[model samples]
Target: METRLLEPMESLISAFVLITFLQTALGAQEFYRQPTHESAVQGSSIVLRCIIKNRDGTVQWTHGGFGLGTERNLPGYDRYTMIGNTNSIDVDGNSIEEYSLKIDNLQLIDDTNYTCQVSPGDSDEGIISNMATVTVLVPPSPPILSGKVTIPVTLEKPTNVTCDALNGKPKAQITWKKDDVRIMENTYELTTTQPDGKRVDTRGIVTITAQPSDAGKKIECGAWNMALKEGEPLWTQATLDVQYAPKLTLTHSNPDRTIREVDEVKFTCSGEANPFQITWRWYRNGELQADVNGYQYTIPRITRDFHGQIIRCEAENSVGTTAVEHSLNILYGPKFKGDPAHVSVDQGERAELVCEAEGNPTAEITWRRQNKYSVLHTGSIYVIPSVREGMFGVYTCTATVLGFHEISRDIYVTENGPPQITSDATQYASIGDRAMIQCLSISSPKPIFVWSRNSQPIDYASSGRFSAPEEGLPFGGKSSLQILDVQEEDFGIYNCTVINTKGSATLMIKLEKSEEVQMAVIIGSAVGGVAVIFIIVIACIIYYKCRHSDNESYAETDSNTEIKKRDKNESPSEMTKSTLMDQWRQDYNYRYSAEFDDVDAKVGNTSGQYVCYDTERYGTMPTNHTNGHLYGEGVDDLGPLNRFENSYSTGYIPSTFRSPSRTDFTSGRVSANELASGRTSVNDFTSGRVSATDFTSGRVSTTDFSGRASADLVEPFRLPTADNTTSKLATNV
Candidate 1:
């Protein structure tokens, strides 16, 4: 408005000022400009920008009023970038007016107020930019729900339920629900931030008191955050548990609990319980029977031992234990009263057997053969009209009752017979040889045997040189008689008699000597006759003597009478008879020669006789030097010769003949009294009063024989008579 003098320098200054005003309005210095709030996920890149209208301004960045970077210096900065220098260009190819403070990885520490300040080169005063907030968005992870998880839980106890949310940028919220209904209770909550300050977590807990009505109900927990997606809340659930004791109810099909032996019996125990795990056990008569895992118990076979006994079943678990009992009434089968041993019956005889038994309920009796199922009879008494040999077997008597096992008894039947002889009735044997006669027979209970010869019994005590039957036989049904050495007397009738209670039988046997025995007797007689003749000749030549006339006959008569009396008493065995027979022969020969000499020679003379001396009696004739003739003296006594002469030769001879002495021949006047005093008797030799050596070599003194006479007379022999001859000479010769 002032029109003053117009100079050229002033006009140039006004046009230049107008151009400066236009440039100032077009480009001005400003710090960074951004939205009031910014959002980014953690671990993502973000920028805090400061925009300027002039590039000549100096820019600096600050976090919460603390310096982060300047135009020329960025002190102790990491993961942070400053961009847009003087030579930088934007997307539109113009100078870039934005100074960016960039963090490469966004974290929780990056989520705060950031400030940008700028001072233009022309002005020294700085201008501070508006504050901007960065938010790190994070979503919660899967939740954890914890509590008691089993069903039918124990009652009246405090059980805690909890829900938790983890790793959320903003703090999470947790809640509880029951059966889809929200729950309001004294819930405790806990919140926590991570050590790096990047995430936040929340946990919530609630306690529930369990009741019977809460059984089988569902409880749930939920976790949520602002950063969560739609319809994606974290959830977990649990159900309530209840507990109780067992209640038992037993069941059986039997209305009265009555059973029979061998019948199948079953029992069951079942009831309601809180926890269904149950174990069952069975007991009988107050004793444990079996353990059953389930609710049922069974017995396949019941016996009389279990009758009137109680059976109990118990069910047990962790909650409680309960039991139930059932009493059994049993009917038993038949049992034997008494058992009989095997029976023996004769063939073709009738048999009757009775089987006695006892039972609770009377049993039905039946009879059958063993291994043959066909029934033979239907009564306790079994009878056979006529028992045959084939009917001898085992017969079973079975007693049976309804609902019980069968009991059986077996009876065996056998047969018996009477004794019968089956051996020959005649036996032949040679004399002086062994012979046997066996009487075999068959009978039941065995038969007793007795052997008899003629009529006398032949037993161990009576038999001589023969063996009778022993008390028992080698073979069961037989007996034997063994004649060890048979004689003429043993050749007679033999009877083997067997007796039993049933009957008696006799087998007659004739024991005959063989023909060879008769021939042997004839031959022995002929040989003995020749021997006797030779003995008589030798005796006649040895003892020819003069005879005493009247005394000889009288002496012989007295000796013969004495021997006859002595022979009546003593009886000798066959061995003793043989010994006496040999002595009889010698005595007979001597006595006969003396008698022949008495017929020929006169008394005290050797003429008209055989002139033989007694050389056999005396060892030799003693020389008679005074008479110029041989005379007999010093005679050894041949003991007991004439006394036993006929006793052995025939049957038994009496003591008929006296022992002749040397004095009887030397002195004819000697009487029988003196001869008897010095003579040996037959009893002395046979009865062992004198030894055989004393008989054979006895000597009589010359003084006794000569009777103190002068040695002038020859002794006269005491002659023997016809009665003194040996009976063997009378018979065999």
Candidate 2:
């Protein structure tokens, strides 16, 4: 009874659970409350939501055809998240919400469909919501147009152009526009994925043939997409360079290309091309002339080598090259060959005058007389069968050309004449002066002359006084006889005789002397010599008086002190200016002052004769003169020094003082050092204290100071001691 009751209860319970499962299964549903199709830019966040009103079901999300995550947890995707049950929150708080798919860091690959699903707790079947698209848009990159940097495009040869847009989502579309006008030409496109795994690449290409009118026209490529917010396409443009070979021409400024030899030539090459600044090259007879590079080529000097040559000009550019050619014709002016400007012929002789020249058009030759206006000959040679006196005028030979000056040669006909004197026959010359007698004559075969004195022949070389023309055959000959340093003996007739093979001529000259003028010159020279002696005696007398007075004006107080001053009105102090000789004179006593004049004597006079006295020699003093006091009074007795009778020596100067350069006597001044030997005069005052000590020690003889010891000379005397010490007067000379 218990087993039967349990079986019936189990059947009722199973039938009731089956009916509830069928009802839940039939009621399950899923749908996206947010947009079923949505869009978002790359690098943004998005959501795919499923809001199901069935309170007993669970929700899930999927990307494309793959599951995203369930309500519990996501397995492989970290950027994907699901929110459901009590943890679910409102997105914008305006619609029913459930577990929704939230994608962060949106990229280009995310531009696909997303779905949401809902199922009852006990059902195996779940309803999938319509896919919601997240279009992660990417603004297309600025379009890039690529082609050759320098393209030679033209209608004759068409070319292709390509443009590309990179890193854009949903592959951009490319179009072409030429010169702002849309082109309906076929465009090819290719699509590719970017390395980022996020964006797409799009490329477009088109073929075009540029026409002449299309040069400088702009061709543009535009990349566009639906996601563009500004509603304008990304574009790039390029300018077309229509190409064509240059139109070549060879031109010249001159109407005639024909030129003279040694004349300059210039040829210019002109060209027209789509691209300018084309290089130009020059060729001569197919050979390149590397020196020329400019648009205008010049030939500084054309020569015979360039005659009949072909000149070509080639203009080249990226498009193509063109060439032009010109033929040359070179002409030259007439040039004389082996022809002289002037020719001569003797009377009654045969004469042949020839003129020759070569030119492009052979020069025409003619002959005529210079004064007469008629032609003499018509060929290269102008012949005179027998030259006569009537043919003595000038004749001309002319060579002519169209573009040059006429060339000419002259033949001067002349006659020969014998020698004949043309000037007067008489000439006169003075004695004791040079004389010349000349014979002037005219001759043809030249002439020779002979000269004679008093009818005797004169040999010019032995006479050493005649000169004539040197030519063996002299024309307009001159013959002359000359007497140089003339004396009474040369006072005679001179004859000049000129002779040639044809004839001879003669001329004569007469010379004489005056004795009165010679006697007057002798008397004048004797008078001049006597006047010179009288002037000398007068100057000496004046000098002696002046010097005697100067001596009496000075006085000596003591040897140690300087020369005492004199009365200012009488004389100036001798010590005002010092010299080597003045210092020495301070120690001596003499009739005439040993003191030299400080003022130089007047020159160009006989005053120099009075400056010849030698003060250091021994001689007789003039009888009446002496120092102001007695000679022996107040003297410094250092030794047995002799008193000089003639302190002013007019005698031979010693070798020691005989310097050829001495001018002190004429200058009226003396050097104290000159009172001693020349070696001492130059070095004594400059030889330091050693020489001073030697002088004071009396080792220097009187001859050292006097320049020489005379027959009445004194022994060496001690120089006066200065404060009992030797004088330090000497130093380096």
Candidate 3:
């Protein structure tokens, strides 16, 4: 098959060589012109040309050894036809014959080499010309891509992505690119024969190691062939979804400001991640705090201990994890770093006191006298140029931090080394228990301690309860007040004064109750308070029910007192007014004073004078008396004779009641108000609704209303109170 396919190509080359040699050996002009190549797209028309000296013999065209006769159209290839019969003049005055092939509706099968053959009678042998190639290009389909639509971060492996171009003539050449840049490594192409066996398909593959930076990038699969236009290739692309883990960066708040105790600080974590649903974790000094699904971490109260601590923030997504760290810088208050300084000097000499302190932002030092808070010097050292008798006192040194706490220490400037109380001597104890009060004094000579209570020395022998114990120590001495069977009187401000040859020192020791005793006292007080409140509430409820009860009690008949009754002519209010007016008139200028003096005459002579001899169920009621006058009344007791029974009517004289004449023997005048009326006001004297003017006008207000009364001959009215305590009114003038 190979030999048969090459026979036409070999014969065409031999004919081309013979024509060239004959022209060169004979030194004669060429008879034929070589055909130039012709190109066209598939399904389009193309023309192939052949030129010679003259039109003297028959001309024909052949493709690959198959001949097309002198007829214009070919046998099976209707698209192939011969053209050109006239001559086209050259630079020389020579005639030329041309035979060109015209193909219409060109297809891929028409792509082959063609040559021309001529026969000029018998004298000139038949000749075949050199071959001219006819190329027909068919464009392949647009590139189709498959594999790895999204790539994840893979450190141990690589991703394989593929692209294909199907059934292209001169099989398409395929390649891969990332975001318009070509990829060279781990890339290859494949070619497969198509079904018709005339064309092939091409496939391109690229293996890559995915990185976090490749997220949201583009991967391009391009196909190029002879059918494609120059500088333009068939391409397809996909935006890469590279699922990568997070790379975390941490930021904090208040970079310029200091973080003191009770200050707040905030930290935030952020990074680029493929899956945005990431989790964050916070750590301090390598200790994990908590796992947070968010990015912010807050320290509500930053302390000084966190100054050198390391803060870490970690972030994680579906793929991996990352972290960042920062060291904290915290600020705090100043403090005295070393032992308290002491300076000793003579009456007229120089001395210095140095104060050493430490703090964040550094501490400032100042010096002042003890008990005198004014700053005397500003520095870490205090120098006294001259010491005098007036300067023989304790000095104080203070270290201060701006906007923070300050500390102070005292420096003694004594003429001789004196005793100074150092430790707190306050103590706590319970009654019936033993107690010990301690006092530590610093001095060269041993200190002698004396415990006293309220400026009086304790009589140990008299009470047999107190004793003074002393101890000698390397620095100074320790003294304690010991009490056996401590009583309540022992808990007080007890003075512990230490005396030495150098100087004297005093300490006030307050003995207080212990926690258990104090708590017991509190509980006892609470229980007692509840009991008292319960008793008071019960008493009030009983009083309310008894005072408001409808049934009234009766009082003993007072035969030595005057009797009064309700008057039919007076309303309840006017009766109240007449009662008060009668007191004002009968006492000094009171007109009713004479009426009570001669009660027998008035009852015998006056018909409508008064009557109240009947004693019934309503004999007692609460009464009210203010400023020597009765005012209040009881509940409804209305009737024809004593409508105000069990009320102020007990003290009133009735105007409608016909007093019995001398024949009607009546008992001595009875003071019904004093004997039967009840009293319940917190104050002894209670006022009523009637004002001073109403009492004077005899038109007083009672029962929440106003009524007129007779001022000349008035009755004494008594008022009742809610508590119903018996109250008395004077019947004698």
- Best-fitting candidate, measured by lDDT? 3
- Give one digit per residue, the lDDT tens place, for model 2 in 1-733: 8998799899999999997876555454434364367787777787766665443466667677777656445778777777544433335322244766777887766777887776655544567677688878887788888743333565566667788888777679898998899888767898898887667899888877777788778888899986676558887888877777788888865655567788777788887986776988999988999999977889988886676789999988766678999887777666678634333335577877777876656777888765344687887877889876455444566888777677765443333444554323334456656765545444444567777777788776777755543322112344555568776677666666667665665655444443344666778877875786587557546644643454345443444211221111221123222332333433221211213221111001011111111212211011101111111112111111122112222221222222222221122122222232132343222222123333223223222322222212222222222221111211000
Looking at model 1, residue 133 earns an lDDT score of 84
* Candidate 1 lDDT, 542-606, residue by residue in tens: 42221122224444546353333223223334443343444554554454331322111111111
TM-score of 2: 0.28
When 1 and 3 are scored with lDDT, the better candidate is 3
Of candidate 2, the 10-residue stretch with the lowest lDDT total is 600-609
> What clash count does candidate 3 reach?
24
TM-score, one value per model: 0.28, 0.28, 0.28
Superior candidate under lDDT, 2 versus 3? 3
Error of 2 at 207 (Å): 4.1
Q: Could you tell me the TM-score of candidate 1?
A: 0.28
